[model samples]
Target: MGMQPMEWTENALIKRSTDFGKLCALHERDPEAASAKLETMMQTVRTMLEHVGVADVNNVEQASIITEILTKKFRAMHDREPETTEETNLIRSFAQIHARVQQAHAALQRQNGDKDTSNKSPNAPHDNAVPPAA
Candidate 1:
């Protein structure tokens, strides 16, 4: 047997992120679009998950965790939506932005992985990153 992979125990969603400004600004400015985006993302993820099993449950669960945090942030804004917290503005905004980033990241991964060749050395430089001078 070989060394297994390690699992993240914390919020892996935004842990590595240091930037999300433009989308977040748009989220704050045009909340309606953000709401629609959130709903669409949730539906997309939910639909994709319909065919997955326990082994693939991590994605949905991660989204849920992010939703909880976003809900709390929404509450912190003090504009509590009594009738429909589920449809709150901030929560929707956060979900919308997060979903967009996640989708883009996945697409980038697919694009990058498409170029990975078995003949390449494991220690070789990544195609996306600039290589150092010789």
Candidate 2:
């Protein structure tokens, strides 16, 4: 039987939230904070998933799921307007990260789909193929 999929338990969510907060704290003060933080955030997520046994950290579907979860958590937790410059910076960085993640996933999906079509057998029947004569 195929292995069971990893469950996103409460504990895992809490741990990820804490990690994200810490990462934001560390990057919010940097000069190129937004870009650097976004890059680090992506890498951190990839590392987190790799450690948790996700077969492919760069898998488009997995990345999309993680991005969606994180985006929801972030919106819920930071619903209020930013009260400080640091908070504003963090939010901006998060927005950029979210947008980039979405774009990357779309691109990867398209690339994979193209490869799938290209790899199809030459003799395989396609939707547009003409019917054979009796």
Candidate 3:
């Protein structure tokens, strides 16, 4: 069944990634044309990332997560034998980008998580106040 409108989700992204098989078939039929199309597609995705200000100061973590999700989807789609160096690099680049995003996301989550828990920590300034006389 077709997905309902505005129903985009991580699962939906993962499911859509399987459509890469069409690109693979095209590559088999017309390697030169497929290469050009793939390059254009990659450039378009990079442009979209730039438009969203990914890996930038504003909304850093969220943007990084979005980049990571896209990288993951691309990685899943291309996790197969590569016929050329360019194809191999494409896979490698996505994996590398995904790793970097995952690391950055984890660091940000940890940093934010610590701030959230600090106030409630037993050793926090307010929590360490001396008891009042009864």
Q: In model 3, which regions exceed 4 Å deviation?
A: 1-16, 51-83, 110-113, 116-134
**What is the C-alpha lDDT profile of model 3 across 39-131, one tens digit per residue?**
765564444334433334334444444445545555566675776787777677656544544444444444454566634434234333335
Arranged by TM-score with the best first, the candidates are 3, 2, 1
Question: Model 1: runs farther than 4 Å from truth?
Answer: 1-12, 15-28, 47-52, 56-63, 83-134
Better of 1 and 3 by lDDT: 3
**Candidate 1 C-alpha lDDT tens digits along 1-134:** 35333233465445312112233345568977765765664554444333222343355455545445555544544455534564455456556645544444344434456475655444334564444459
lDDT at 74, model 1: 44
Winner by TM-score: 3
Better of 1 and 2 by TM-score: 2
Question: What TM-score does each of the candidates earn?
Answer: 0.33, 0.42, 0.47
Q: What's the C-alpha lDDT at position 67 in model 1?
A: 48
CA RMSD per model (angstroms): 15.5, 11.4, 12.0
- 1 or 3, greater by TM-score: 3
